[model samples]
Target: MPQSPPTISPTFRLATQIEAILYLKGQPLSLDAIADCAGCDRETAEDALIELMDDYAHRDSALEVVEMPSGYSLQLRSSFQNLIQNLVPAELGTGALRTLAAIALKNPLLQTELIELRGSSAYQQVQELVELGLVRKRRQAEGRSFWLEVTEKFHQYFEVDELSLILAQSPKHNGTAAITEEE
Candidate 1:
């Protein structure tokens, strides 16, 4: 006889699991997709989804799970919008953002290739990015071309680390309190 798939945990509803998966994937998933994943009917899945939504209705969090007409997705919560905006240096303008976006999307791209893709202004923008410590230059032995990589600081600012590992590294109130106690 064929073995059945393992049962899902009851601690959090199937929809909550779906939400966690969506957040980790950083993309939206349809009801059918979520139901298929959670091994439940659409109605039960949606009911669980509603309950999960209620759980996240109003509280401070970096991200929130939301359901759109097409699918469900996890996104940065609006309350932390300012925090995100502050993370990036104000000196970096739209041109810099576009340049960074291009570089990040096509990482390890050559400086010449980036210039060709982003135009002549990219050279100056790249220099600026280098000064800002957002991008680094790496030599590509294949063609002796230099490529840019995002720095650890950039990752911290973005809270990427698969889930705010940056925040985890920072000194928290409890940590400071312990230090004071030792003193």
Candidate 2:
């Protein structure tokens, strides 16, 4: 008779299944969703989640399992943020990205100046960037227009010093026109 393969326990299988689901989703998942996807009960899924979290905490892995009100997600540890940023850039639309680049290159830019450089569509782009938490707007003292600046989130996301290095190599950074438009 052929030797039979050893069977894995239900708890171990559920934990591995939950880890795979979280990895594939690349986003937070609710306990209900995890249980449904893993074909297990909520209690089983919770046990698996806790096990996975403990596993990650005890391992030499660069990733961590986080539980938020929205759900649970696997994410890189904060210490690896600078390294990860160089590998994976933010996923912004072209218009919003261009506006972000312009803002970063010329920080503390006035709203009127941005409009002058990129046209009225900049208003919508700025709104989108602000919503994304990559840009901040403050009212100018002398005018109704706002002054736009990149936020700390932007720096953390993109590695601001790396941006400066890239910008320095670009020819556009040379002799860039001054924002002379009246506020």
Candidate 3:
């Protein structure tokens, strides 16, 4: 008899399907979006995402399924990003860069609060940032967790006394973080 493809569980198959969608999109995607693209229901998409998360968590793979502020994504594992460091530009990825920008915009931000805002994945970003000398992490004296601030190196690296000025001028920012620059 023609060998029937080893009957993969439906959930596993769905997760694999969603993985492909995430890979092709090259960005975070909501469960609903994944459902629509995969022609599956939202619940199934969510379950698939969960399954994918577990699959990646267990497999010895260099990629991961991470839930971002926007949605779920399949991307390079942060731990592996540095392995291929010599091949890529010596710069943080977009997600980490965004996290750094957020810290700069809100300097002296509490690490807990930053994680709450950016999600747990930010922990890795903060670590990378501290290693890069762009951010400083120090434990709070009180019972609270660590506090994060932009290092002096941040200003020199970005070449600005105030990053807010640069962000405010960006039309995409909608001027929400805008602060008046003294003439």
Q: Who wins the TM-score comparison?
A: 2
Q: Quick one: RMSD of model 1?
A: 14.2
Task: Extract clashing residue pairs from model 1.
Answer: none
The segments of candidate 2 whose C-alpha lies over 4 angstroms from its true place after superposition are: 1-12, 93-124, 127-183
lDDT of each: 0.72, 0.81, 0.81
TM-score of 3: 0.44
The sequence of per-residue lDDT tens digits that candidate 2 reaches over residues 1-183 is: 964323435655667777878898988999998887777779988998999999999999998999989999988888899985577756777888888888877787898988988889999999989987899999999989999999998998876655656655666553233322222
Cα lDDT tens digits for candidate 1, 103-157: 7655556898888788999989988888877789988878877978777766676
Ranking by TM-score: 2, 1, 3
41-123 in candidate 3: lDDT tens per residue? 89988987898899899999999999998988898899887776555435679999989977887777899878888899999
Q: Which stretches of candidate 1 lie over 4 Å from their true place?
A: 1-7, 58-62, 88-183
Report the Cα lDDT for candidate 3.
0.81
Clashes of each: 0, 0, 0
All-Cα superposition RMSD per candidate? 14.2, 10.0, 11.9
* Candidate 2: residue 80 Cα off by (Å): 0.9
